[model samples]
Target: MTRVRVGCVHLLIAVSTVWVTQAQMGFVFPPVRIQAFSPRGIRVSVPDVEGITALLFDGNINKRIMYDKGDIHGFVTTKTNDYWVLDDPTVELHSGDVINYNVLLETGRFENSPILNGHFKSQQRHVVFNLERRSPPDSSLTVAESKNIKCNQSVTVVFNNNTPICSGQIIFEEDFGTLKEDVWQIEQYIPTEDPAYPFVSYQRSAVSVANMALHIAAKLQQTEPGFTSSSLYTFTLDLTDGCTGKMCKKQPSGADILPPVISGRITSKNFAFKYGTVIVRAKMPKGDWLYPEILLQPLIRNYGDTNYASGIINIASARGNEYLVANSKDYGRHVLYAGPIMDLKCREQLLQNKILVNKSWADNFHEYSLRWTPQYLTFSVDKEDWIHIEPGARGLVSRFPDNCTDLPRERLASSSELAPFDDLFHISLGLAVGGSTEFKDDLTTKADWPKPWRNSARKAMLNFWKDIDAWYPTWKQPELLIDYIKVIAL
Candidate 1:
């Protein structure tokens, strides 16, 4: 009788356990299916659901969520007494098959965030639902809208006739990554010394591309009695040895003479643009007697008897005596000159303007740009327009006397028609030292200069050269860091 009672008790316990399991099975929820995905967020659909009591989701989608002060937690929980908010959010859902919400958490607390387990209790059931996040499509990967386009990238410009101008895209760009030989031609030819200021020379070995930026440095070269600096020149393939064919070689000399200064220059002679915007980000070199120029040389050297204008867009002229006088107010040491030059023989400047910045140009990187159009040419520093030249502005004529016989017919007729600049032009970037005629004249007349330096500008340069070792260590730091040079057709 006792054994039979024990068997009956065991059977009753087993039956109760099965009944509890069956009741729990009725409360299970369906899995959440991913419908779509995007960079902004994801979409999901839940099936066979009536009313929801609690819904939880992972809020940390795009970025990591950290529990720190001032850190944004992009989630919130309502009905504070019923729901325990995890690091994620506990969402309360009404009866719906499809629900949409942003993946980003806009506002919430970061302290004691809860983990997402996809477990929730409904009005009629205790449920465990499977949630999935889909990956975004490949078409979603794209850059944001920018005014400046990358090299070789196409930009559509709509004309008045509704025709799209996409063919004249980015013509050239130099990021200084292992210098492309086909696009750039490094200059090796020696330049003739200017009679007014004859002191420095150009060298071929001074140009180099490293650390993803073009470095043009000036260093003292040991010479016979005095120290001189070398300079680098890019572009001007015509100035080089052979101009017979596309494949030209730079002239090599067996001369053992060492120049006092060594620098670097690079030019884009092969790539010329008619009307476009040219932008260059560069850091100027420090010290006295340094002239860093970003200019456009005309493709056609001469358009008649007169020499064609080489657009002097941006020039950081010598910070020596000329700058000292011009920039009397301690705004900046560097003197900025920008505009066009029509005749090289007379050296007349048309639409040129001078500006003084508030900081040393070598202290940080700044962008210098020139936007050339058929109507006008505008020059800017870091996108701030300091000089604007329209067609018929005063002093636009190439000749000053107004009765000069050598003035070009097109230029003489109307100053609005910008000659020499209308033709295609190539870009030139170079660093020159200690031979500016303007600076030389200032040193000769200025009484503010030091004793021996007041009369002789060359003597002051020599003094700086004597301490070259103390100034120039290597061509690495504080170089003319050319981040990039980009050209886009207007």
Candidate 2:
């Protein structure tokens, strides 16, 4: 009788010994077999099993064998009484090699057993196992490299084989390459008084494009035999030179003073858009009394018209005085100004002013963008941080000050119907010097101007202009670096 016993270590423990008899020679006892058995003196086919096992007894079977050169390498076995060697005929094996094999005893269960080593000599038993390696995670890959990425815009990437790895699009872009004459005109007009900085004088010579960037520089120029920093202009008309009628009078000697600092300004006079996204990537100059501005101006400069209320959008402004008063440490140097400036009553209600309190405007290049639509306008820095303003939101009205009022009842309350902004507006980029009284003392009344807060603002501005030479570095580069300007229809 042959007996076999198999049990899990965690379940049961039983022992059974098998006795074999040779009938022809009388009774013959055989020792219990736990190891594999192979037929003696039998030459097996290449990659064919040479060994077989009847019953597995104690622990799981783990076998490691060394072989000489052979084509038969891997192995497979069924516990019912058969074992088969497996191999790929295409792969050749070398001699004197070590191979490890782990075999599970149960059909569906495997044992966590350590590997055991053994020595085997066979030239035909050596084989190789074919396995494919997996790729690493996507997070391990670097960012895509692309050359078409414009300033403030996204870009896509393609592989060397012309297969696209990633994708991006640029709607509108201007590199200021050699100044597209049809799209841009150098502003030649000098304002009698600038709305933001009244003391600034604009000059036409301050604007230029070189090295693929728009350069607007503020330099110390000789104006009226004195050295001063003034802004450049796009349009300048001598009011006294063109008039010949009785209504014309001789202009004052200092009435049309040349701007002390000559800087550059360019305007898209012929090209204007109603609603779109505008992006300007630029680096600001460093110094006191300097102002770099990116703005949108209405085609018609009238206050009474419907477009006037929404006409002006101050996308980016870096005023030295504002930076000094706000103290770049407390408030950031970037400022956004939006609202209806034509009427004081409407201005209070619609004014959407905010200071970006995080980054330094003059330290490095930054992408300043404005997303303008008929419903609302959004200002953003690097397209990450944003501020949204809806023109007709009554919640924006101010309730302070007994005499203050909201937008007029008869006026169109929504941004789409507002004048100035409703019409097409040309873009303007300029750098000016000095401070404007428009923002002075928070534009408060005389009584409020005497407060300590107002006093500190005055002192800051006074100190800036008093030690102008100390604050303004004459040798340093005095130009704003504009990498590109882009506009995309919303």
Candidate 3:
């Protein structure tokens, strides 16, 4: 063991073990895993870089890898929790360099990335490593050739496929080229008890991707493994494996029953952005009371107190019904809606958020776009203008109903004009059937086809299930088809 000085801290290097103590997570640095992605570029993946900042090579090279956003390549996206950081392997170690001191470690959230919570602060501790100087691959070799021959994970030597992909503006993109769990998290939750009170519960089997496009289809609940037509109403169902909804469980009563439909939802919970433009190509389903949720919901509810306080930007929303008439008006697929959902009443959301067309959206696929910035937001369908929302000088409060009130006015006062929207938001896709708040109770023509259930009725699910013959047969296309989704940072 040898003692050395780094900046102001004293460090002890265990020459034999080559170990460094990470006190925050209680991890002892042992045998660092190193890899070469390029001819000269090398990276080290540490299990947890909690309060650490940059890793140093021979005390001469310093590169910030823990929280790097300068270059897209620097921000390595990984499925594992280990932190992968690019180290400048191009620089060679000189004589008398302290091999044990590999980390230029810094502690405290204030000195680290802003995303971290500033609840703890610590002075730099003794972190040291001992290593024999290992040279990088010869700089003369081409990247492709270097990847195949020198690669340790044996198979066919392929030029480093682990290299970062940097395209302009695009931050998160999915062609459904195999649903990546690190990106699109397939939901395994159910809304059975106090569920959104929707007639459907999310199941994995209902979601699939074919021909490079994702399809979220709705199926009969009885088709699930252990469920049956009569058993659905008999046994109490709980989606406890990954229930994102309510935990309360209640036995099926006379009118109250299980979710009669099986549907699914997926979210990009692993990734989020502050301001970005999103484009989605999708075809709406042709069925009664089916609603497609293509939305960007807030990652943090920094504004108001309620669940939807941070706001939700609806990329595109269209009903499945093609010919449902309401009060001499057609509220079917002929109508498309897009807007920022601020509150549940959100008169601004309900009244002014709709766009009309002569043709039904379910007839063909449509390109839905959202251009969100710090100032204004524009929603478009098929590249045509749908709604352009640029709030007044005071912000969105002016557009909302008076009763909406100063919903946590204190926070909004100090925020940008796009308070709720300016914060980070992620993408979500799902299909829902027959919900209370979505459909108005008074209107919605079920008379012609015999609307079985009232939106406000306590026995709404039972009523809809009893008259399945009427609506189920009308489900010409019960799948919410998503061709592709892309999010580009502004």
Candidate 4:
């Protein structure tokens, strides 16, 4: 009796399980199918897949689909083509389900986002189905609408079109404390990369860079959707306290001190010596939001203490230690702009020592070239005259002849000019982010700083963290594109 009862219970359980399985499998999804699209009208048909849940039609042509999961995430930008099949990702069918779908062609440039030009028609129009596409129906959403960032907090801004900034950092300053009386100091640091680290290698070093080229590019889509629209700026490269004329002259023998070029691809082995022009081309992202940068720093000796003074020299003009070189910037996207060599002619009287421009650089690439030779030095844009230094110009180098160590009378025989322009006579490429560092924001180009303020802030900054060794190093990959460098002997 017990064996029979147990057997009967097992049979009932198995039959109930089968009934539930069939019931679950019986759920049906509507399917819509399209025959073909033409200029005339639309045709419809029944879904051909069996056990199907739904039917979908992708009729938009040239539509790009960005996917996150199995579903379509968004649309990609297209240039000339329209009419694409809208991508659909969520339809799984079984053996016996059927659907019918048709499409209608679109004509002119429709203003709708996703710009739908086609329509769909199905045989069973009353059936409810979910629309399976990424993004809303409207496609005209600007970068601003996509990201909800406040403008005041945005530090890094991009210029795509007439759109507002979409992405940036909002530095929430957490005040620690001020330790000193005369000087207000904060001990906390962001622990970020110090830009002052010594540059180790460069692909190319040239005398000039091309003006009309792409300098930097950042793929913003994968980043914070905030860079959809940004403004671009263009500024003429300038160096303060620059050297030129007799004050800025170099000997042909001193070419060894020029920055060494390490190349494995070309037969030139290194940057070749040049006599005509010294142009330094660099690139920055185009548009008003990006800062166009050109910096030329002269080599100066650190006299240990009591002397934080440094003199400027022209690199192309100096033949030995105490040389100075002007650097230029040319915007290129992973490319180098070829330019002319430089010559620095001695000048007698000086007018202005710096090149100043007040225009904004946007979209177009620019070449900032400094032409220096034995006879004259000219600052130009794409070879156009921007500023010039005449022969035998007189300035600080002449007033402080004792301060100028490169002169024949000032240096001892042991202090050779051939000293690898490494320590006291070399130049550096740097961007100044003025905060509390010795580099303050000089909006007026002021010549002197208040003695107390300078001592308290600038002196303290240099004392605490000027040397590359003093600060921690942080590695960063920039967005600038660099190409092969060329050094020709003029």
In TM-score terms, which candidate is top? 3
**What TM-score quantifies how close candidate 2 is to the native fold?**
0.49
lDDT tens per residue, model 4, 210-302: 322212232211122221211001111111122111111211122112111111001111111212233433333321111212322222233
Highest lDDT: give the candidate number.
Answer: 3
In candidate 1 the C-alpha lDDT for residue 485 amounts to 86
RMSD of 1: 21.6
Model 1 TM-score, all chains together: 0.53
TM-score of each: 0.53, 0.49, 0.63, 0.26
lDDT agreement with native, every candidate: 0.44, 0.43, 0.60, 0.23
> If the candidates were sorted by their lDDT against the true structure, best first, what order would they fall in?
3, 1, 2, 4
Model 2 weakest 10-residue run by lDDT: 12-21
Alpha carbon lDDT at 307, candidate 4: 17
lDDT of candidate 2 over 203-290, digit per residue (tens): 5567788865889887654442334233112223242443222222222232233343556677773456566778888887665556
Global local distance difference test of model 2: 0.43
Question: Candidate 1 regions off by >4 Å?
Answer: 1-168, 193-198, 223-259, 304-312, 315-323, 326-332, 344-348, 351-358, 393-395, 398-416, 436-440, 444-447, 450-479
lDDT of 2 at 203: 53
* lDDT (C-alpha) at residue 156 in model 4: 21
RMSD in angstroms, all models? 21.6, 29.2, 15.2, 26.9
Tell me which of candidates 3 and 4 scores higher on TM-score: 3
Question: Compared with the true structure, what per-residue lDDT tens digits does model 3 show for residues 383-414?
Answer: 88768888766776556656775355556657
Higher-scoring candidate on lDDT, 1 or 4:
1
> Pairs clashing in candidate 3?
100-129, 100-130, 148-157, 446-451
